[model samples]
Target chain A: MKTRAVILYGLLFLSVFLVLPWIGPESIDPGKIIQFLSGNNTPDGSIFWLQRLPRVILGLLAGGALAVVGAAFQVLFRNPLVEPFTLGVSGGAALGAFIAISIPKLLLTWGPFSTLQVLAVLGASLSLTLIYRLAHRQGGVSIYTLLLAGVTISIMCGGGILLLTYLSSPNALVVFQRWMMGGIDVVGFHELSALFPILLPGIGILFLHANDLNHIALGEEMALGHGVDVKIVQRDVFIGGGLATAAVVSLVGPIGFVGLIVPHAVRRLSGYDQRLVLIGSFFLGGASLAVCDALARTVLAPTELPVGIITALIGGPLFIYLLISRIGK
Target chain B: MNKPIIELRDIYYCYPDSEWELSLSGLAIMPGEVVGIIGPNGSGKSTLLRIAAGVLSPIKGDVYLAGSDLKQMDRRTIARYMGYLPQELISVYDYTVEDIVRMGRYPYIKGFGAFKEPDQRAVIRSLERTDLTEFKHRRLSSLSGGEKKRVFLASVLAQEPDILLLDEPTSALDIHRQVYFFRLLRELASDGLGIGVVTHDLNMASLFSDRLILLLEGKCFRSGTPGEVLDSSVLKKVYGDGLLLNKHPESHRPAVLPRIGPEKSS
Candidate 1:
């Protein structure tokens, strides 16, 4: 089973990196792709390079980051259902997006992220910090406390989002609604470039804690007995998840289930060694989101559906299945 | 003079949610012996092991590991000298037997580290000791309750500590496995490792342990050789009535048998 998971996952992952970029709104000629690669510029090269390529890469990174972060949170909290979204990070990012849209667009870009993207990250970081504080003040952050605090913070942010949406004029409403229904529409390499620096380190830190995570998976008390610094690791991992999820949510608009579903699928497919699960979550998540985006782009042809909806449309059934199975069990 | 592997002095511990308080002036485990703790439920037997393992801190006490204070030493340092096995396993992810055992080497491993040759070798050694070398590749979920217990025991053995603290190590095992496990502990103890086991099986405790500490209401009610500690007078005080006693035919060690009748006790 472990061997099959690796092989099937590798094949699926490779298919996206090799094949999915070929299908988009405007189909690029394979001949043109070869010519562009060979340094002979084709007429469709800019459309392919500046638009399609960055978007695919962004989908890969965003999906992979969310899933890895999800796996980390699951292990840290000792609950399989925990994802960045459940922890109120997406709520924070959603609030940031709402705030960014409430005011007129600011002409600012940090590295590759827009001023709006930066605000979403800052908002996510702030929200997680608040959640962390609430959980930590009681001493040793138990899983129940974390989930409770997360839901409370998320509800609070939801209230804020409701107020912002209520005050919006019809003109702002459509744009706000579109942004809220996230899509991977990187206009150029700039946004992708900005995300790489933040995403890479965040991903690296989470992956590096696989052993500690393995101990933590048994239980927090067990982890401490195995010589883990539970308090420090918990704090650092929460920040790491916040940083990565914030970066992805800033640009991709809280693309749900990548974190929630991908890590889960990886663990079920492979065994529960964090060393395997984290890396598998990265590749599988990247490929899965890329496929979702591809379906979003080609399904409507000229009109595009938000990639987030496409993911939800597919992943929602998995969630219900999990619920039914849990109830049945 | 040979230093005791672990020593506790002037220890006071309390649970925040409960009214229980435990205060002990001193308890120590020397190298090369097995010490058994027998207590009623909530008598702080498990709590003592947790404090000694550095999983919990006493309100006021000094814990010495090889002459260094436990509070001053980091968790990794404490783990280096001592290994602890809890009463039961947590709800774990799908992990192979080998994967669970290898986690015992976490203290020796560094940041994002690969399992080195020594780590793998230690895992193999532990698997061999626990009679689980053949089952190393099996999934933990598929194992029976007792086999899973051995897998966790293997994980602790892989830690290769100077001392072992086990809570109820024989609860789920068959009689044969329980005897086997205790024999293994005796062998390990004779090899210069201090072992402290907290269990409710008075018969096995008397048979295997070099010394016994009987606890009640968070205090050590009796501490001596098993022969002295397992006396009928002490058993009656700790366990109340309906108690009968026998002896192991081969070892001639005391075996406790409890009789239950409707009118025996309230």
Candidate 2:
């Protein structure tokens, strides 16, 4: 089962990376892709090179980041239901986007980031800092406290978002709603390059601690006894996962279920080893999101649905099926 | 005397916002010996065991591991020569028996790599020693209580440490399995590993341990040979004459029996 799932996910990941960018609303000529690679300035070449490819790459990176972080956090927190969004990253980002939309005077751009993205990241960082401070104790941060603090902050952010929506004009409300329904619509490599700095190290830290996370799943004291510096692992995973979630949520506006469901689906396919779990979640997650993005782009042709909606439409039923089947087993 | 594999001297410990405090003047476990820590509920048996294992640090005094200050050593370095089994093993993920045991090699793993040949052999040997070879592929959630405990024992065994510290390892096992477990510890001790166990069963402690330390209210009341420590006079003071000490029928080791009150006809 493990071998088959690995192959299946590997194939899916590679095929999605190659295939999804070719299937957008306006199909690019196969010859144009080669022409784009050779630096031609044709209209078709620009569409394929500058537009579709970047969106596809963003799907891969953002999806991979969320799932990998989700897997790491689940082990670190010792809870199966935890995901990237559980730590208030999504709530904070949404609130930030809402603020940007409600007040157009704040709609300024900096280098690669729009005002909304910048504020979203700032909002996520704020929530992360608050949760960290709340959970910190004399010796180390308490996992129980961290979970509770995150949930409380998420609720507070939700409330803030609600108030902003109530006060905003209908024009701002439409834009906020669109952002809330997450989409990955990058036109070039600028946003992708901007994400790399925060995203790389964040994901890298989680991947590096895969073994420590495995020992942690046994229990905290057990992990400590087995030579894992549980305190360091906890701190790194929390901050690392938080930063990565913030970056991805800022860019894509908090796509749903890819973080929550992909790792679980990977665990079902593979076993509980975090080494396998993290890697499998990355590939399978990347593939799942890229496929969803393709559906979002073409399902209504000119009228695109949010990729987040497509993910929920597909992922919700898939998650339910997994749950029922697990019970049946 | 042989140098103690692990020793704790003048240790003081307490949890924050709690009145309970433990102050142990001195304790040591020498190689090829089993030291049973027998104490009533909340008498600091588990805490002492954890201190010896280097999992818990005392606020005052020194812990020596193989003649070195334990506080100065990193966890991986400490774990290389010592194995600890926590009392309650709550596995968050449903890992297989082999998966759990393989984790015992965590201290030895050099980098971000797969378990090597030696680690695999150690895991297999541990599973075989604990009689868990057939159950290696089974998930922990599917196992019986006794089976689960043995699985963790196997994990600790896979570490191949010179000293082992266990907290209430047999509290959940049946009588027959408890005896089997103790005998296994005895065999491990005979092979030159020092073993420290915290247990509630006095009779089993008497039979298995070379030395017994009886604790009362955060202090060591007695520490000596099991026959010397399990005296009726010594027990009466702590247990209030509610317990009787007698001889094991075959081994002649001191065994404890509870004294019954006056019978009522109903």
Candidate 3:
């Protein structure tokens, strides 16, 4: 069953990337795109390979990572409504990036040791840790407290980012604004390489504990009786989920509903096996983001909208529909 | 037939602001014994079970499993020999019946890894035992209330513990399912597993249990066979109202039928 799902998803992914670029306009001609992919390229083909391909790949990776993280958080916290944005990791990452861009000199002085991605990851980790610690009451953390804490911290972090944006130089402000508005153009192999180490380990750990996570969803006492180290599982899930969310934010800005929508869609298809959910979430998320990115690039031709705008535009109505349907059920 | 599998020594637990600590000075549960713990709400029946299951560490005293102190043993090691089902049923994911049942093999599996062949067989066997084989692929949310209870019971059964502890396992079930489940528990106890069930149904407890422990105000009000513990005076002491106690016609087990309000009684 798993093998079949993987194969089907792989074909879907291939067709999306391979077919969509060909159907576009002269600037992104299908033949040139193919030639560029095959390593025999014109200037236009080179542009597509270097610029468009990286953006697409990054969107796929970031989307998959974010969706898995959101799914993990929902399970770990035992709340169906939890998502990357709700957990404050995105806001924390934006603050980190805002700080990094505003103080480029301060960052540069660290001797090639500074990057927006690293800062974003650090900020996300710290904020998430703080939220976890604060939300914990007695021996356990309540989902309600965690959600409230996440929202509170996110608001605070957003305020800080706004302050930083206002105080920054116009050039820095322009860069930060574009990044915050959710540009896919900045992603490249270098950023992807930076993202791989943290994202891969975090995701691997989550998948490893998928069974325990399933037990946890039953409740803490039952999970412990089943021999789960509840505290360790909780810590690992928070850190891993936070890191994965941060990785995506660092790359593509906070591309909204992929994490929220993909997991919900996958859950409807995959039942409740966390292993299948995790894997299926990766594919669904990647496909969703790829479709969104394709639309973002092509919908207006010469003038492309921010990928975040596209996701929100598409995601809002879908989210509302899901909300109403869930309530009805 | 065998040494006691669980022994509680001077166990005392107090909720944060409670005036008095719930105390069980000494309690011993032998292998294959079906013990029913009965009390009103807030009488500490569930609390005692939680202490026995190691979900809550008693403020004072020790719990011994197989004569070894539970505090000394790791939680996972203790879990291997004990299964606990809490009062509430909250399944976070929409896991299938089989997947939920397989969770019982969690302790045996290493480091949250994939299930082994033995785990798979145990899960299948448990599903069969619970009569949930046909519903194995169905999502939990799709199951009826009775079905969900059975699935949860199946999950605990899959744990294959030598000792089973349940808190109000049948409180949410209909009368028919409750009777069916109590019969099932009796069968399991006959198979040499020590079972401790906390419940409010004195009749069912008397019918199925080999011994009964009546808790009132954080202490054992009475402990004996159902015939001795289910008397009118004890019922009056535990619950305010005096009730008539008699043997059921078919089962010849003690059953209590409390009087209703004054108008109905008159």
Candidate 4:
């Protein structure tokens, strides 16, 4: 069953990978796409390669990162309701983006990062550091303390975002509101190249601990008995999942529900093994977000809805159906 | 005549900011013997087992595994030789019985791809020994309390440890299954595993155990052969007068029975 689920999710991801690049407000012929791949310049080819492909790739990376982090956090915290943003990463990133929008003077680019993206990364780092310090103890970070600290910091960041919203000009408020809704509107691969360094290591650290996470979900005592170094696993899962989440949120402006629902959807379809769950979540989450992004682009034809809105709109109802169907089964 | 496989000497433990403390002068589990830790509520049986398993470090003194200091060894090293079954098992995911049991090989696994043939054989043997082969694919949530306990038992068995520390291992099992489980422990002990069990079933402990450590109020009340430890005078000091003693029909080991009547006015 789990193997079949893996294959099914892989097919979904591959189909999205192949199909979504051809799906946009402007229809591009397959021959033209192949022409673009072979180095011919045409209007359709340019749109397919430069506009649609980057967005789809960004969606896959960001969605996979968020979902994997969410799965890791749920196991680490031993709470099914946990998401990637539960630990204040999104709150901090949103606040940072809000700062960039409200204060025009701060909107300067540095290296590969725009000032908005840089500030969002900084904001996420600040919260991650603060939460770690608050939760750290003599032996290690206490999971309960870490959870409480993350929540407190998240709420504080939310208040800061509200204050920034209240103080902003109407135009800035509108931009900030749109940023808060989240999107993947990259024109090229420059941003993705910068993201690979952070996202790869963060997600790699999580993947290495998949078996440990499996033992951990049973309970700390059981994990300990199974020869898992509970303290080290706790610390690594926190920092790794935090970094992955911060990287994705900093770029995408806090896309919701992909992280929250994909792991659960995977666990329901696949078995509860972390190895399979993590892999299934990555593929299924990437596919789900890619499909959503495609819909966001072509749903109204030319005036794109934020992919974040589409994800929440589509993901929430889809997850409910999955749950209801399982119950009915 | 064999040196003790696990020894706890002059150990002391207490939870932080709590008045209750557990202090022990000495305890040991010899090779090829089943040592039962029988105690009243709050008598620290679980704590002792945790200390022996190296899950809980002693506040003071030493725990020795095959004469090496326990504090210096990491959990993985200890787990290679010692298997511990916690009293409570709760899972957030609907893991299959086989999945849970397979984790017992974690200590032996290195740079994972898949379990080797030896690990697979151990899992199969554990499931078969526990009569759970048919239920290998069943979700843990679908099992009864006794069945869940057996699944954990199978997991611990899959570890293939030299020493086993179990807390209330048969608490949820039926009468027949409990006896069968104790018989299995005896077989394991006779095959040279050092077994320590904390159980409330004094009669079963008396019948099955080679030695018994009776505890009262976080202290060892008695430690000896079942006939020596389960004497009415030795037990009355801890249990008061709400008990009766009988002899096992076959083994002639001392057995405990609860006195059934109206409660006496204090």
Prediction 4 global C-alpha lDDT: 0.86
Clashing pairs in 1: none
Tens digits of per-residue lDDT for model 4, A1-329: 25787788788888888888988777778788789878888788888888888889888888988899989999898887789988988888778878887899999876667888878888888998999999997556788888888899999999998888788899998888778788887537777666776788899999889888888988887778878888888888888888888788777778889988999988877778898889888998888888888898889887888989999998889878877887898
* Model 2 DockQ (Cα-based): 0.74
Model 4 ranges with Cα > 4 A deviation = A1-5, A29-41, A136-142, A326-329, B261-266
Model 2's alpha-carbon lDDT is: 0.88
Instruction: Give lDDT tens digits, candidate 3, residues A260-318.
Output: 88788777765677766777788778777877887877799777778889888998898
Candidate order by DockQ, decreasing, is 2, 3, 4, 1
Per-residue lDDT of model 3, residues B1-266, tens digit only: 58888999999899887696799888888888999999888889999999998888899999999889998887678878888888887887677888788888877877545678888888988898888999999988899888898898888888888898988999878999999999889888888999999999999999999999999889998999999898887777767664678889988888788665653221
lDDT of 2 at A153: 93
Measured with DockQ on alpha carbons, how good is candidate 3? 0.66
Candidate 3 wrongly placed segments (more than 4 Å): A14-45, A107-114, A324-329, B72-76, B110-117, B250-252, B260-266
Candidate 1 Cα errors over 4 Å, as ranges = A1-15, A29-43, A105-113, A137-139, A318-329, B245-249, B260-266
List model 2 lDDT by residue over B70-113, tens digit each: 98988888888898999989888899999899999988995564
Model 3 chain B weakest 10-residue run by lDDT: B257-266
In order of appearance, the predictions have TM-scores of 0.92, 0.96, 0.90, 0.94
- Which candidate has the highest TM-score of all? 2
lDDT of 1 by residue, A186-290 (tens): 546876777876778888888767668888888777677677888778877888888898888888887888888888887766768787788889889999898
DockQ: which candidate is best? 2
**lDDT against the true structure, each candidate:** 0.83, 0.88, 0.81, 0.86
| C-alpha RMSD (angstroms) for model 2 | 2.3
Question: TM-score: which is higher, 2 or 4?
Answer: 2
